[model samples]
Target: METVLHTDKLTKTFGRLCAVNRLDLEVNRGQVFGMLGPNGSGKTTTLGMLMGVTNPTSGSFTWFGERATHLTRKKIGAVLEHPIFYPYLSGQKNLELNALIKGADPANIEKVLETVELSDRKQDKYKTYSLGMKQRLAIASALVGDPVILILDEPTNGLDPMGIAEIREIIKRIAADGKTIILASHLLDEVQKVCTHFAILRKGSLVHTGPVEEVGKGEEVVEVIAYHDDLPHILHEFRGSLSVKSENGKFLVRLRDDFHSVDLNKFLFEKGIVASHIVTQKKSLEKQFLEILQETTSHRQPT
Candidate 1:
């Protein structure tokens, strides 16, 4: 895959506060990449630096293997929080104004509007449109320049479920068209659904980065119940067991990364124990995310 964006030790600070730590990241072309983190994890600050709106205190980034320049901004479209559109003007008019500012050909405006499904309401005044429609318009404005990459920060923020679904569909469609996307969102489920690749940040530092499909490939969790009175003690002593908890009269056992239910079953059988109930399930992205955060927290704790 071609490298679309690369950052080497990218750092940003405001006085004593390090908004973004030394971050190294790479995004491949045509991949829908997600930046996942809590609100204060420096996601916005990092995007600001990448988009040229904020300067990095130290570090460097490149676009398409070349140092980012003013021209690079033309090839990338972005929409941040609380976008401003002319309320009194029609949706079409607002886009036309935006296109003028972007130096994009006016001919592309209609295409972008249609792409965002706003053509039917093109003549409607911006103020009259619902919140979802406004967000779609903001996206259309970004698409007007025919940018190869689109950066969206909380694109579905403050919207109803239906609005979120609409924006999600639009993003999928855009990604299907082979455009690289950098989605900065605190919504884990949304990122899991929309992005092929992801990076997790905590306290302005990168904690995890990988393909979304590989999120829970390692580690296994199983719910089990045994007739033996010593089930809890046996579970704790199991070599493969990482943690065990009792929930709803069943023990939820988390195994080591390289261990599975088979290993646990074998060990139990050796001890002359047979489980009355056993159910195995792969760890979910949400679980993996929480575990990652927990591990980072533990590492940071004072000894």
Candidate 2:
């Protein structure tokens, strides 16, 4: 895949405070890439740097394997914070004005509006649109330019569940069309659902980066239950168990990355123990995110 964006040792400082630290990243073509972090974690600042709204204090970055300039920026459609449109104007008119300003083809208006499912409301005044409709219109403006990449900051923030879901589906559709997307959001679930790759930031630093699937492919935790008398012996005999604790009449066993629940059951069966119940708990992205934060926090503390 072609590299759409690349950064090397990117750093931003506000006097004594570092808003973004020595960050390095590469976003490939056709990737739905996510930048995830809590508030004040520099997610927005990083996007700002990429968009050229904020200058980097140090280091450098490139878009499409070349230096980012006004012309290069035109190839990227972006929405930061919120979409802007005239309240008195219709949705189609709003897009037309945007298309004119962006030098985008006027013909793109109809297609982009339909892409966001706002074609029916194209003649309706922007003021009459719902918050979700307003957001989708904002995305429509971005699409008018037919950019190679999309950069969004908190695309679903401050919206109800239905609104969030609507925006998410639109984004998924855009990614399906092979447009590279780089989105910065604090919503872990949104990233897990939409992004193929993600980078977790903590206090202006890059803490973790990988494919989304890898986040859930960590060590397995098996919940097992055997006869009351056999439980203690099974726990004591399990060599692959990392930690074992009793919870709700079952043994919650944390196992090494290579271990599985079936392995535990096999081990017990060989020893003449029959487990009444056993289940493998699939790790969620939220859990993995918290664990990464905790690990980074611990590593940053003084010895």
Candidate 3:
């Protein structure tokens, strides 16, 4: 896959505070990449540097294998905070004006409007539209130039559930069309649902980066209980078990990725042990996210 964006030791500081620290990133084509973090974790600051709105204190970035410049930025469509439009202008008219500014083809206006599901409301004035409609129009403006890469910051920030869902669907559709999307959001659920790859940032440091699937599939935790009192011995003898600890009168066994609850049960059965209960607990992205934060926090604490 082609790298759409690459950063080398990107750093940004404000007085005594480092908003972004030696951050290295690689965003590939045809990927919906999510920059996930709590508020003030450099998500917006990083995006700002990439979009040229904020100057980096150090480091450099490249777009399409070339250093970031005005010409390079033109190849990317971005909405950092919010979109601005003339209240009196109709949605289509607003997009037309944006197309003119970007030198984009006028024909793409209708296509982008359709993509954002605003074709029906294209003639409606921007101010008269609902909050969701307004957000969609902002996305439409970004698409006016038919850029290959899209960067969004908190796309669903202040919206209700329905509006959030609407934007998510739009993002999914755009990603499906093979556009490289770099989104910064604090919403873990949204990233898990829409992003293929994600990086977790905590206090301006990258704590984790990997495919979304790997985030929640690190290890399988199995809850097992057996009728026999020799459960500890059986657990210790099970080669597939990574670790086993007694919790709430039941054994919580951590199994390797290649092993499952059934595998553990079979191994115990072959050793003359019968488990009365076996439950596999699949990890969630939120859980993994919290764990990463907790681990990083512990490491940062004074010893």
Task: Give all TM-scores, in the order shown.
Answer: 0.82, 0.88, 0.84
> Which prediction has more favorable lDDT, 2 or 3?
2
**Candidate 2 residue pairs in backbone clash:** none
Question: Tens-digit lDDT track for model 3 on 1-303?
Answer: 898889999999999999999999999999899999999999989998998989999999989999888777767888887777999999989988988877889999989888888999899889999877888888998888999999888889789998999999999989998999998899999999999999999888888888897765667899998888788877978888889999998999998779888899889889888788999986877888998999999889957
Q: Model 2, which residues run further than 4 Å from truth? A: 225-229, 235-239, 266-277
Model 2: worst 10 consecutive residues (lDDT sum) = 228-237
Whole-structure CA lDDT of model 2: 0.90
Q: Give the C-alpha miss distance for residue 13 in model 1, angstroms.
A: 1.3
The TM-score, computed over Cα atoms with residue i paired to residue i, of candidate 2 is 0.88
Candidate 2 residue-wise lDDT, 154-257, digit = tens: 88888899999989999999999999999889999999999999999998999999999887686888888887576766676788898988898888999987
Candidate 3 deviant stretches above 4 angstroms: 223-253, 264-279
lDDT of 3: 0.89
By TM-score: ranked, best first = 2, 3, 1
**lDDT of every model, 2 decimals:** 0.91, 0.90, 0.89
Of candidate 3, the 10-residue stretch with the lowest lDDT total is: 210-219
